[model samples]
Target chain A: MICIKNFLTILVTFFLILSCVLTAQEGKALQEDSKNSLISGSRSLQFRISNNLTLTSFEGAMISAKKHFTSNSALRFGLGLDIRSGQEDYGAVEEDDNLFELELIAQYIYYTSPKAPVNLYLGTGPQFTYNRHVQDRNYEETGEDAAWQYDRSWTIGLLATFGVEWFAIENISFFCEYGASIGYQSRYMESTPYQGYQDQETTQFRLSSQTVDFGLSVYF
Target chain B: MSRLKKSVIAALLLVFGILTGTISGQNDMQTTQDQQPGPQLEHTWSFQAGISEYFTLRNFDMVSLSVKRHFSNKSALRLGTWINFWARETSQSEIKNWDGTNADTEIENRYYFAALSLQYITYLSSGKDVKCYLGIGPRIRFEYWKTTYESKSDALTRLGGDSGEIFAGLQSNLGAEYFFTDNISLIAEYGAILDFWGYSDLYNYKNELSSGFRFSLSPLPVNFGVSIYF
Candidate 1:
């Protein structure tokens, strides 16, 4: 699986780079055409709230800058912040988990036509996440004994997104995106009746999310 | 490679070939469009939420409540909190001395369990109607047992117990959605939870499989939610 994932990653990176070069060449051609001069490009900021069918709920905000390279092509770069909360159940207990995520992204958009208002975007990015788990319980049973316990952890991951943007009004537009990310986490456990267990080693667990988000943005 | 491995590899390669072919087709489309004037900009934004119920298939009956969100159309994050009510009943045989007669004894017990998790979802399809998602995350759980026993003579006894622990795990899901409107859809999902713990000679219990304990459960959950485009 790792091999396959790596292969796909390489393939995607190659294609993405190739597309950027092609788009850049197109931009140069358009610049040479006196009839079609590149218009203005600026910054766009957006906020979105989303839910997974089985994971935690997320709320995020992002600010991005776009530069038009041609009459129909542009490049965008952005930063985002997100907060997540959810709960998990073990046969013996349940704990509530909260996470904070920071991400950076770069994307290239190729406008379909001068007369149309549609563009296809391809983007890749990385995210750093901090997760804290709060285990709430009345008591813990260890065979004949009972006590209290808590758990916490932090993780990091890579993100990739592909989507399309549609502009309905002059300066306002809506966008839908699909994204996937992978992360590895480090965890710790503690107990109230006794000193918490020290660092425990486990496989680099994989954390991933797929989302379909829709939000409105205005270009400044 | 074994036959099974060979078959798996073949299937995978076939899928990859099909995907690359489709992408090449899209590239051709782009080239054709490049000859024309500049391209149009297409954009859309949306928000969605849903609620689901969880049922356990183990010896004991357990139920849970769940809620989730989707940001774009493919990435999903879910936060769920669930409470499990456990119940069991058993019968024992009692012998009466001197007379060859047997009396039946009945016993019952109940327990409470809860779990919380943060999960990330990834969708593989480009289209919204048919989509597959993969998810994984960490989970914390608390379990408590309350037992009440009744004897033939109408005697009652109570046993109180509780346990709390946090485990790391992976979550994977496959789902499909049908849209009745552009902004609203019905979703059905199936997924499983895998939990892992360390090997501890001091903490090992007879009921546990080994010094290292791991457990899995499949929660087939379904929900109906509304998606609003921004």
Candidate 2:
């Protein structure tokens, strides 16, 4: 009975795959006639946002740009920096939380169909991220000493990306991408002002299909 | 054995039927579109939210959101995300048994999880107000959790260490969506995954890493959701 179940599962999965392939080819029908969209020496600016469907609030906003070497290929660079400070107060107690983050990414993108309105693309490059966070708590009437904690970390990695892009008009396009990464992280943490700091290092490998990134680009 | 053979034959026949039906359906749509020239309701942006099986099964513990942009009536790009964050802090006071003094304890815990998915979608068939489409994309996920404890008494004060894990992974999914109305639709999908996890003793700064790969299929139509187009 178990063998039969497994076979049935595989059979159904195969059918699904076949259906996808057949329907995927139908994408050509959606292409609109647009010319000269991808040209050499063209520079484009891209703005990216985390793929949050509700758009309740936006997080991880990144600005990047691309310079086309050829109609089929380009070099892209991105830089991001963010600082946050928050405080909480409860009568005689006060708490503060602060964070600082910076990231840099450089990648090479290759478009498989440069002339088509809908293009499939692949990108690979190096990425680095740094973060610093501090938290503090203070008591006024209780005569307790103020307590603070600090943490810092930096990550360097190589990332591979796959995505699809659609040009709505001659000068504007929207793209969606996913990435996999292998990297290293170094971290330092201090539990309290009096306690000594601890240093740690980690080697990381990740395949993150769940972090779908969405972005728009405009050519100048 | 006889039953197995019969099942295999049935599966093959079903596959044939589906394939032919899909091809003929596309043809029929084209012919209908050509015959009737009406206002095409094509919206470029859509938003969707629903429940998923990967995080938690009961009481809608996991919430998923998705947004799609249609390049044309036949093709589109979709991005979906699931993000959650929770934090708690507690304090307790009790009398020490031996010292007959007040003992105070404080505990803090925090957890976060997020997943993002992207796919290219193509419409295979369409009816008057319904469309059947296929979508495939990559998914990435991250999770983190940490907890710390502190205790103070008359004679001595002790601090408990912190422990947590930072996990990240990638996966690929293939799914299909059916639009029942001009503005509403439903989707179902499955995928293969590769995940990596890092365990840590935060106070001591000790870390360990592990990774694995697997295939996931959440019984058909279970990982389903609704979408609204604008």
- Candidate 1 docks at the CAPRI level of incorrect
lDDT of 1 at B3: 52
Candidate 1 chain A, run of 10 with poorest lDDT = A52-61
Best by TM-score: 2
lDDT of 2 by residue, A101-161 (tens): 7888889999998987688899998889998888877785775747778888898888888
lDDT of 1 by residue, A99-210 (tens): 4445455556555553344555665555554444444432124433233454555666666666666655433456777877777767666665554553444437675668
lDDT of model 2, residue B78: 79
Error of 1 at A195 (Å): 10
Model 2 residue A93 CA deviation (Å) reads: 4.4
Runs in model 2 deviating more than 4 A are: A1-32, A47-62, A85-97, A139-144, A193-215, B1-230
Candidate 1 lDDT at B9 equals 65
Candidate 1 residues lying further than 4 Å off, grouped into runs, are: A1-40, A49-115, A132-152, A193-209, B1-230
